[model samples]
Target chain A: MGDIDIANDTVSADVVAKFDLPAYLHSQQAIVASHLESALEPRYPERLFESMWYSLSSDGKRLRPILCLAGCSLSGGDPELAIPTACALEMLHVASLIHDDLPAMDDDDYRRGKPANHKVFGEGIALLAGDALLAYALEFILLNTRQVPAERLLRVMHTLINRVGISGLVGGQAVDIECEGREDIDLETVEFIHTRKTGSLIDAAMVTGATLAGADDDTIARLSRYARKVGVAFQIVDDVLDVIGTRQELGKTPNKDEKSRKATYPRLFGVDGSMQRARELVDSAKKEIAPFGQPAVPLLAMAEFVCTRTS
Target chain B: MGDIDIANDTVSADVVAKFDLPAYLHSQQAIVASHLESALEPRYPERLFESMWYSLSSDGKRLRPILCLAGCSLSGGDPELAIPTACALEMLHVASLIHDDLPAMDDDDYRRGKPANHKVFGEGIALLAGDALLAYALEFILLNTRQVPAERLLRVMHTLINRVGISGLVGGQAVDIECEGREDIDLETVEFIHTRKTGSLIDAAMVTGATLAGADDDTIARLSRYARKVGVAFQIVDDVLDVIGTRQELGKTPNKDEKSRKATYPRLFGVDGSMQRARELVDSAKKEIAPFGQPAVPLLAMAEFVCTRTS
Candidate 1:
């Protein structure tokens, strides 16, 4: 049976009970969420800060930064060492969302069931706010931060930038834009676009967390594999939900992928095949965590959660 | 009479005879130029790198980075230690120029008498190239290939990011955009725009050079004063040139400022008053260096050069 099916049975309850994770998860959320808010406190232009904070404050799973923390924890390193870097990833994610919502791109009037940034902040300010957030994200990684080796810090920056740059997020975005209105897309194209659009930074986030904690090369390599599988599964689930989910459940417009005629797993592979592929990817991601044993439980659970999430 | 007038009539040959620069400058330029080229090499898309490098390699005075090197030399630091950072600033400058040239801002189709980045590279590529350059610039600093002291390396990054953030370059750009098309901008508004836009990075570059070399706070402060004077003077000359410079000499369309009716010193102060203020600023800038005596000769000459340059 798929992990999602198992999760719907008694196994998930046992996993949660065994881990005793509610308090830990809530505590981590509070800390991570507060750090994200504080990291975004604007030193100038109150409106820009308000706009950025407004979007960031909106409801969503704090998935990536928490995964960064989890990756650090799994490697026996302090999550505190990776907090700013994690926040940086969150900031970058928000920037992409803001830009993706532009009239020229996805043209979405709503995000998370609320008016999009461009809708409320004015297109120009929203555009600049995204740019400011991106620039500030890098600044957060490189400046006013505590101890990490200079060379390692350099690596952190290099990895983040590379993941966020053309070969990663932006390049994926270009292809995604081009993909709009096209009916012909294969699995490879979907994978290529998703890998860059989502996978690169997700990969960067987990790897950065581990690296910041001084994890060994092999451990980092494994974490990268885990992140990649999870990333792909995450995107697939998102695509599936857009086809099946209600607007209220998803907290945004439903069926956008279908309505836009955007290439997606459901459109390309049929619903069952898309579901099978997601499960396989999740299994592969879990396998990468096998050596980490119990310490890897959270990551594995997170991956399952990503694939099975209703919204 | 202007410094150029004096140079042509009385001191051109004698100045050249007495103050010929060492061969190190040529070597430094070659090394820095190579690092610059290598930094922007394309990865995913072949055309991306070429588009980025084209503007960066365009002929113009690389005054800010060169000033960084000179400050490093004056502080008795290894010039090589300053080289990558020097290149980083140039990259940053190029990034700013790309963004500034967008249709939303200066709207210049031509820069340095050639098609602007948006005109040549397309807007999407131009935006990504600028973003990539900034990311790479910070990465270069953190890499610190020269083995700068850990504390010093941290300081250099702190200075650069702080000066480049909203309170500095980005903030300056926002204000400049706001000031555009306004006919009644105050002196304070103009000063705020110029100081943050041009002055902060220049000051950071010089002060960072000294701070890296272990210069005391007082000396770094003095260097800052020198940079501020020259930076403001440079902008004033740019403003003056917009009114009087020929297309060939300016290497850009000279009549845009007037045609657009952008706020400028020449527009506000008239030709003669703006020139007078620039000269006064240059004198005050020179006075800031009086304590350094002959050691500041190069900096003084640079100040004069800023005021006199047609382009």
Candidate 2:
């Protein structure tokens, strides 16, 4: 709290003292969870919806959606205006997770401490549910976003799709798949995979939120840089957690990355070195938005939270 | 050609005589193919793009994109304005095909006289390629569309996504999978499945084209009705061909649906009866758009093409 006040001169010490990051994250998470719950009501073809909801409702941190809302607020826009886009971000995240856990992909049996989507619904329905969720995320944003210009909405859509398409998340996953079980994987290759696989969507989440809130290009760019740092840091922490934490603590199988021989930050740098790198990234991420002062409090805290979080 | 002149009082006999359906289809298909060829350039992660392009460039009728362009032309908009969207429709169609051929779904080994996507590229890359194409379709539309108002583009996106999401293509597919091998499946369930699985995307193609061209509500609705009829008829013809055609002509294994004990139009109705039903649908589809006069000539010819097509 003292560091935040010292970093942003425009943020008063009193406000810093009163701000609670956990409470803010919890409240924002609740809002996103509620919106997601009401977004899809069970209809005909109950099985598909059931499978979709099963993965969507899993107990996990709603990190991407929370970042989106925080991005909106940091840009001096009403957080309420970003709810639909927030939910859409989570939907895309869950869709990717469901597909990633398939037998043909990562073959993970557990996710967030629950059976993988295919394990419960079988592979066919799980695949269709993922496809449905991807399309529905776009539909939900187009139909539900309000009080924003059409141009802004289109920009948000463009950013979201671009980050998720071939040049971003999908591209990263493809390269990662190709590199599996290879002994020649380097730090640069690992960074490339993590940057696009995890970092690109995080960039989209923040950039889209700020875009929706009418943030100028400079502000959006700054937030993007901030997000990139935090994104990589977040993944590094995940790697460290995977090596050092248990299934009960991480809500996933521990040491699975080692078993698969997948390249990870901890694998190359060891847990202590990787954690030190994550701290440096979080520090740089906070500095990127220091000029925004009071408006960026939540985002600054979120950057810190990335390296500190256990799961 | 004679029936076309008789069906529309506003179309002159001279115009009907000059309108060659095959030549027109060939020209439009060439244009769509050219556009699609240029849309995706080879980039990094060469294997992924190779897999995506392999399926996208397969030999098939460019029916959906042609319908979209025709829809735009019918609404008096420059067909060029709808070219990006036309390409996007084809991308979505190809993406669905790739997924539908997966081992967990249809388990198809051949498509369009060649190996299925998963057969050529492993199932994981095939799945990711499908995901990339789906997302790229949205990104392509947002990036390439010009000379259209942002509001109309949003509406078009909404319609495309809605039809492709639950209660449309995905919902239809879910039910189809569930009803497979069940003898008690009735005509109503089959219609319900076909309407969503096949009909919805076709409806989206035409309706989105009209919407982008500034068609009135009534005209868009009329075109949707026309699309729904042709879509069902198109599936019926596919069913008939599955029963009566060979692998050489169909470009896939014949009678696979029957082998799987899946319900189909020809399964419920004899091949002749299904063909007869398709003819009736084509006739009614033409009636729905006849009021558009000479502007609907391409679509009118397309309606006839749907039933008469041998592949």
Candidate 3:
């Protein structure tokens, strides 16, 4: 049976559990990762290609791209048609990570299980590689995606640009970098950084997928609200994990946020309070998707999974 | 008369001289510059906004964007309609300059008679500022542009991404950085670097204008040829300037390329030979546009202008 049919079935708990969200997410991740593998067949300067793919081939949670694909599937749109868009989201994420890990930015030496791109390729190549990925992400969608109408593609294009560009991703990153080592950062500053840097892409991914699936304005607005909650919750949990989580569990640096004096939710709110906020966000996010009913079952499960991943 | 009508005038050398190209270029530059001034209006963080505009408001020639507007006007399209696309080209160019001037890249201290972005801001803030400009360029076009058809806008978007992304700007930057201080680099390597790094944006600027004006494939191909020749000539002129040019003229460091052991045309061919070669490229570039007859006058003058510019 199709995944949707399995999603629709309210049979025994055993069948219901068989069609669990984790399995769905796993298959989606593999599909997106596999597509991402060939997404960058760069021309000259083999090192540029190497630096770009190094971080991309790592073992991070395919959260944003899967959310895009989930958004598409939930709208009864062809998920296959959304895969290139999915790949684009993942590529943009990698681009941001490559830049963020530079000695000038986050200054981390390790990402995933390997040395950071800058550590392996040097800082200059890493910076250029990040730029390449960012530019190629948009081009890949334009050249590779098929069976989607031009209007939908245009909407998707605008959505990605706003999310990753100045209005969203870059703006937040600037504020985060500026706020580093400052002890007097307020709640407003923390919220601004998290929403722009972390929340923008998540919101864009869901909205882009919904747009590609021919979603209306109301549906898109609801997904935007839902995505903001999920994104803020994700960042709060991330702050908590960085403070107390281990390398084996997080797969990268830990407690670095605290060391950097970054304005984080966990710092502003205590760990217990942060966890409470995440759960509350998850509940509200699920409520936003309530009108979608059964199709949103997986989406609701996603929020729950996000709220208490390792607790 | 419309700009194209004046372009078609060929009564006398005096009239041709009277209807000069500089006046047209000046007006176009003013419009593009004015639009670019308010192109970025960041909401929350003021520092980010300041860092972004610092490089943008400098006293550069504004060549690429003016070329875009000129191309649109030459095609009988509304120059006013091309302003947003023109602004985007300038923004992307500024983004490249910001990143390229970083300590890890060219490591230049000066740009446009002032300190480079990284020299003015810290390394981290400079990097983020560049990212902000790059992202904002795309967003600005998607958000602010009007009256252009969706297909044309899509075409313009694709062109910018390809020109600025891996296959173009970022790829060449990686190679240029890698080849620096290496004696084994050959003429082919120089061609690859200059064409991708410098020529890509020039080509994109011309193609974008013509595409916005709905020019035919034949016309676009001719403009592409024109752009390549002019781009190479510009790079050759740049190489000569670096060796024997001044801070007052170039507005940045001189002789740094030689210090880095860069593969420059003037280094391979003597300075006089490189100048001769530049004139030849300019001559051939003007010839490609000769088929357009009277409407190609400004373009021909532009080639002549490129061949001999002291300051």
Second chain only: TM-score per model? 0.89, 0.95, 0.93
lDDT of 3 by residue, A117-140 (tens): 899999999999889888888999
**Candidate 3 lDDT, B1-311, residue by residue in tens:** 12232234433334334557788778777888789878877565677778889998988788889878777766767877778888989989999999999999999999988999988888888887888788788878887778888888889999999999878889888899999888888888888888888888888888888888887777778888999899989988888889998887889999889999988898888799999999999878877776566667777777778877875
Give per-residue CA lDDT, model 2, range B151-253, as digits (tens). Answer: 9999988888888888788888888888877988899998988889789889999999998899888778989999999999999999889888899999998
* Local distance difference test, each candidate: 0.75, 0.88, 0.83
What's the C-alpha lDDT at position B136 in model 3?
Answer: 81
True contacts kept of 1: 0.20
For model 3, what is the alpha-carbon lDDT of residue B100?
95
How do the residues A53-171 of candidate 2 rate in per-residue lDDT, one tens digit apiece?
Answer: 99989987888999999888888789899999999998898899899889888888899988899999999999999999999898999889999999999999999999888888889
Candidate 1 local lDDT, residue B94:
81
Q: CA shift at A110, candidate 1, in angstroms?
A: 3.1
The alpha-carbon interface RMSD of model 3 comes to 1.1
TM-scores of the models, in the order given: 0.86, 0.95, 0.94
User: B145-259 in candidate 1: lDDT tens per residue?
Assistant: 4767766776787677677766777777776766677889888777777888789888987988777777777678878998887788788788888899888887777877888
Candidate 2 DockQ, CA atoms: 0.82
* lDDT, model 2, position B74: 87
DockQ of each: 0.31, 0.82, 0.76
The list of candidate 2 runs beyond 4 A from truth reads A1-18, B1-18
Better of 2 and 3 by DockQ: 2
**Is candidate 1 or 2 superior in TM-score?**
2
